[model samples]
Target: MTAVVSLVEHAPARAFPLPDTVGRALAASKILEEAAPDSYERGMWRLRAGSKVGVVAVAVPGGETVTVRITPKVPVARLFFLLGYSSDPAGWRDGMVDVAEHSELLPALAHAVERQTDRALRRGLLQGYRTVEEASLVVRGRIREAEQIRRRFGMPLPAEVAYDEFTTDIAENRILRAAVDRLLILPGVPQTVRTRLMRQRARLADITPLVRGQVIPAWRPTRLNTRYHQALHLAQVVLDGASAENLPGGLRMDGFLFDMNRVYEDFVCAALREALRPYGGRSALQAKDVHLDECDSVRLRPDFVWYADSGTPRIVADAKYKAGKRRGYPNEDLYQMLAYCTAFGLPEGHLVYAKGSAPHTSHRVRRAGTVLHQHALDLDRQPEALLAEIRELTRRMVAGVKGRI
Candidate 1:
């Protein structure tokens, strides 16, 4: 039987009587860390978890299996909401992807993926035209004259032909297949879910399995693929967030983890962008072309930036998931936003943070005369209430821009 060590996100370090191999593996992986020497305990290893939450199973020497499970600070359902909203703000609803049945993240995600994939394949696999080029006995479509002359020496037989072949082995089915396979490997998936995932894999047997490191094939949303849109989105989340790796000395590690910092940032940017749509301006997440200096030496990428129809920057904001100090949000974040304000020539900039003891506050830089606003969002709130907060925040941002004009 595999030993299990459970920890909560950002919780205090705990000591565990673990084998040296397992301890060293977890320490080297950096998914969990050893406690500082001052807090260290004798005869046991002290391990602490940060913001990453998920289950990782490490297979060490002596045929021992150790599983480390990190629970998130927020409810699993709320985390799913953040994930779904970040991926598809317009289409994602609270219960659209059912995860209420499972308490753990891995099981919940696996169940959701299985259900969505089943729905997507209910009408059978989608078929699309794939352009294929090969040497064939009979030329079906366009023939490569240059290749025919160069390789075949003008031989009439085995012509190099290119044609579009309609098949089930397309990008959509392939992604779904990859997600199913990934879940089937990870630990903690219920046997029932695993069985269903196996069936999904069988259904997608004809489709090509994705290579481990290669980019996932892209698929577009259209009327024909409307049924696949939800499944495809979830499939990508699985492919991008989960990892399986093999280490030296017969050690293997695999898990699905979510970084709260990334999740919070993505949710804030996506929600704000969706809320700002009604204001009739363009919004960008992580705008890359921005800079703080005229020489373009100091490039700055703000989490969110809104632009006017006239191609001028209207508002800029950054998202911070870190805890605020007793005074307020960190001063470093204020300095970063100030730079953004100066670069965009805006009178005000916004800093959105996860709700802490500190209330919403605004600071005016004395010399620059730029107003920097700090906004807090409570993640524990219901989906509707959380979105309403974003809508209200959008209003404040737009009002600030108008005041400047």
Candidate 2:
């Protein structure tokens, strides 16, 4: 029999009396390592989930399994909205990929993937031209002269050839196949969902399976691939957010989890960029060339930066998924935004937080002539209201820049 434990995101630590092997498996799993710290304390295992929320299962020795489920602070539907919008801001809409029927994240994701993939492949597998390179017995398309001469000793028999083959074994199908495989291995998938996923897997049986530890093949969105866009995007979300691994001592760990911190940041940046599009300037997420020092020794990457039409930075912003403390949001966020302002040579910088008790506030840095603005976004609001808040925030950002000029 398997033991189950439940925890809430960012809640107080709770102690569970777990078996030694089970505790060790959880500790060794990458999910816990990335989300929590020092899980084992005293006799009972003291576990607390940080920003990550989802379900993970560990198979220990002696046929025992342990599953840990972390519930997010936000509603599952809201969480899906954040994920969908962040994944595809232009194409994603509310109820586009419905998770209303399911309560938990994994089942919702599993069902969504199955439904979307089915719709994508309804007309049959999509075939695209994939470039191939191989040494063939007969020269087919274009022969590699250098390789043919050097490797074959100037022989004409087995030629090194390259050609484009139209096939269903492409990036899109492979990604969908990988997602189905991942869901099949996870423990919590409902039986009906699992059966449908198995059908999806059988449909994609002709597609190539993604190799472990290799970069996922990339696919671009185009008119021909329009039907596959939503399914491929959701497949990538699954591939990026889920993990399965074999642990030491004959244990296996598999999970599907999302870091709420990252989800919040991505949603804010994507929404802001969408909102700022009409302002006639380009917005960048995590621009790498930014630095705080003249000598380029101290590097800084703000979550969002908007450039004016003249190619000068007009606004810089960072996203914080943190709640405000008694005094306020940590002073570190303010200092960080201050640095972003200084580096970007902007009069103001912005920090957007998942709303806490403290309302929107601004502080003028002492002696720096730079202002740090903190905006709180209520994640619980309806999607329209939430995005409306972002548009309002965008207006304020643009207005501030124009006022300074």
Clashes of each: 0, 0
Off by over 4 Å in 1: 33-43, 146-153
lDDT of each: 0.88, 0.87
Model 1 CA RMSD to the hidden true structure, in angstroms: 2.0
Model 1: residue 324 alpha-carbon error in angstroms: 2.9
Candidate 1 per-residue lDDT, tens place, 11-84, comes to 87888777766677777777864532324555477889887889999888677688889988888889988988
Best of the candidates, lDDT: 1
lDDT of 2: 0.87
Task: Please report the TM-score between candidate 1 and the true structure.
Answer: 0.94
User: What is the C-alpha lDDT profile of model 2 across 186-285, one tens digit per residue?
Assistant: 8788999999999999999988887777788998999999999999888888889887788778888778889988999999999999999898889999
